[model samples]
Target: MKIAFVGKGGSGKTTLAALFARHMVETGRPVLAIDADINQHLAAALGAPAEEATLPPLGEHLPAIKEYLRGDNPRIASAAEMVKTTPPGRGSRLLRVVEENPVYAACVRPVGGVRLAATGAFTEADLGVACYHSKVGAVELLLNHLVDGPGEYVVVDMTAGADSFASGLFTRFDRTVLVCEPTLRSVGVYRQYASYARDYGVALSVVGNKVEDAADVDFLREHVGADLLTWVSRSAYVRRAERGTVGPLAELEPANRAVLARLAEAVDTTAQDWDRFTRYAHEFHRRNAAAWANERAGTDLTRQIDPDFVLGPSALSAPVAG
Candidate 1:
């Protein structure tokens, strides 16, 4: 199953993303958790250390390419080189290289023995591009890498806010679960986001994050409608983590675990549908699994959705413009 969390900032989005990753791992799925946000805080919230990489943000290349394409003085390299360096393809170039102390090796830390790979920090270019424009575009490319990578599940803790989530990357995943607090602002954000998701290709859902009361959950439900799927109660652990407390959440805070389990169920449920990226993934899995079913049936084929049929009911809703 592949999913992403998107909503406005200060709505506990990073925390929601971390918990979702942890929950997937705990449930025995090999998960690829990505910090697609350029702010690069998801890893830290997930208790993974942030490392500094020298590569540029993928977004930076676009504008640089734009500038260079327009004959402006630009540092962007050739498209072939860009494709060669990062390669754009998920498993190509730097992403697929094997190494001792591989960044993602630790990024995918074990929690009760579940494997997870995540980006602990942004590359130099990633940071610059994030600061410039197209932070969402950079994230989309990064997710393309992870979707190309091997994993049963992919969970994205999107950077703080709705715009980034609404960008193309959100549509790339099978499910987009908006995490929001219960304040009036959050409710408004949830409504706006749910409406947007309906228009985009994302299967929009709402999780009442930091739920503290029945009324709060109901309040979210009133606005989110069918988009509202789960509710996560408030937890001291969330508070502790907010202060920089660290490590895998093997202890499984009750509030945290409850919502995570719901998210897990949501992820599992969404895996069965047709979506934009699902078809390509399905084809990849079909061939790979076909090869393995003969000799490697035990191989994992979870992220394998077919993007060939990214049409019909599964397509994300489009935005209703003025």
Candidate 2:
């Protein structure tokens, strides 16, 4: 499904995207993980062969999300009308109107082997997308490309916070995984973003990276939602990043590995309800509770994030039409 890893800066969204991407690729899905963050860490975490990447501006002067895709999607200006005319054959009939030509197709980078590109940012309806047409529909296309596309899975490592970029894409995703550690500061961000998810109609799943206790999961649940997807605990080998090695994805870390596996299953499952999807996924929530209590929080976070980067606070704060 179209998945967005959202949370505060340095909250582990990128690394988790890498871990999840790696998990799916290994499991037999040809994955296409999008580094839409513009800060662009998903490629680094994947250790993509390209040393240099020409990424588009986080949300620049791009076309509507549907405009980039190849498929049957309607572009109705009225929400009520679009809802009445969604694509022809969906069980839920969520959309009544199809985006005659909806969603953008995956874009490839000059350097990275993977084909990925993000919207140049929706201008003040510069593309003329009205109520029925949503950036979220772009998300639906992304999610469809992941689970229902040629690619086995797609991971969208979002820009910091739960502003428009993340919020816009959240609705199309199967899960809004809260990637963070055990700091109140991070948890506080998760809380705010979760509230955004609640407001935007995006599902949420908590995955703690570099964590050190069950209390961490408890705290996230208390603040965010009940389903804690998985905790990718910290590891000393993370420092290997200095030498360009990935340690957080170590298969040896059964705790994190198991969590990843469960997350894959949860995301893969066919539960359409936001609450039901996370609800079933929560069964594995803190499955290995003590692992958190026993381990020392690790430090190497492979993903690099620059706040001033295009997808950072600037893009997040930039206003777009609702």
Candidate 3:
């Protein structure tokens, strides 16, 4: 299952993402954790060694990605131009999750038991004109093409706010956990995310973070109501873990552990709507291309999504066509 964690900054989305990935790994599942956030701190939160945390962002390696995925295909201009819905054509490549391929080896790193990948941080050089959407595109391409199995899990820590909606990346996940705090601003983000995601039939569940007592939980229940799945109280252990003073997060409070387990069960059991997902992906790709990419890049990239390519549950395993 593919899951994403999204919420306002400082609402502890990354913390929850890391904890969930670690929990999956400890339970003997193969997991891939992607830091799609611009802040790029999921590695540290996952307790990766300093060297592993410094692995370059996959976005920075466009040429190699194109070579590995597209081979000698003349149709693709370059990897940088590939969007979330870019399909593989006759000469293009395909990726099976955790496969022994050069692209996977260069992009993913092993940290403890879970594999980690990141969308590199934005430098000052990207000051005014550069769009973070390019970095997001790299993540989109990876998720769009990679075929995940039943037991394998992919958890992405998405960039904060509604910016991710600019692309169809939000539709790629089976479930999205909105890490909302007991505050108006946090609940406001949930409102914005839900408004956009509802159209795609995306399954959204709220994880109330930093709750102090019954009143805080009451506030969340009042605001989120039926969507609230679970809650995590503020913890000193989490703080120490953030500060690098703790080892693996093995001793989570009993309540928090139970909540995490429930979250995992919910994610694993939820049925995926591939038909809705495919329709929304195509719809957003057209919207984004016509509104921006075509005018800006002088090419109708939307032409790349092949009409004959059927995107069903089995399409994930089938070879892609451009």
Per-residue accuracy of model 2 over 1-322 as CA lDDT, tens digit each: 5567877788777767777777776676655556656355666666554444344532331243322321222222222222111221111112111122222222434222343544334456555553322333443333322223323455777777755432224455656787877778888877787666675556678777777777776766675556566676775544454246764355336766787788887787734453333332222112212233113223211111112222111222333232
Candidate models: Cα lDDT each: 0.53, 0.49, 0.80
Please rank every candidate by lDDT, starting with the best. Answer: 3, 1, 2
Candidate 2: lDDT of 264?
82
**Which 10-residue span in candidate 1 carries the lowest summed lDDT?**
82-91
TM-score of each: 0.63, 0.58, 0.91
lDDT by residue for model 1 over 260-313, one digit each (tens)?
777777666664343445444344334544554324334333322222323222
Decide which is better by lDDT, 2 or 3: 3
Instruction: Provide the lowest-lDDT 10-residue window in model 2.
Output: 89-98
Task: Please tell me which predicted candidate would have the highest TM-score against the true structure.
Answer: 3
Q: How well does model 3 score by local distance difference test?
A: 0.80
* Per-prediction tally of clashes: 26, 25, 2
| Sequence-dependent TM-score of model 1 | 0.63
Model 3 CA deviation exceeding 4 Å by range: 49-51, 71-81, 88-92, 295-298, 316-322
- Which candidate number maximizes lDDT? 3
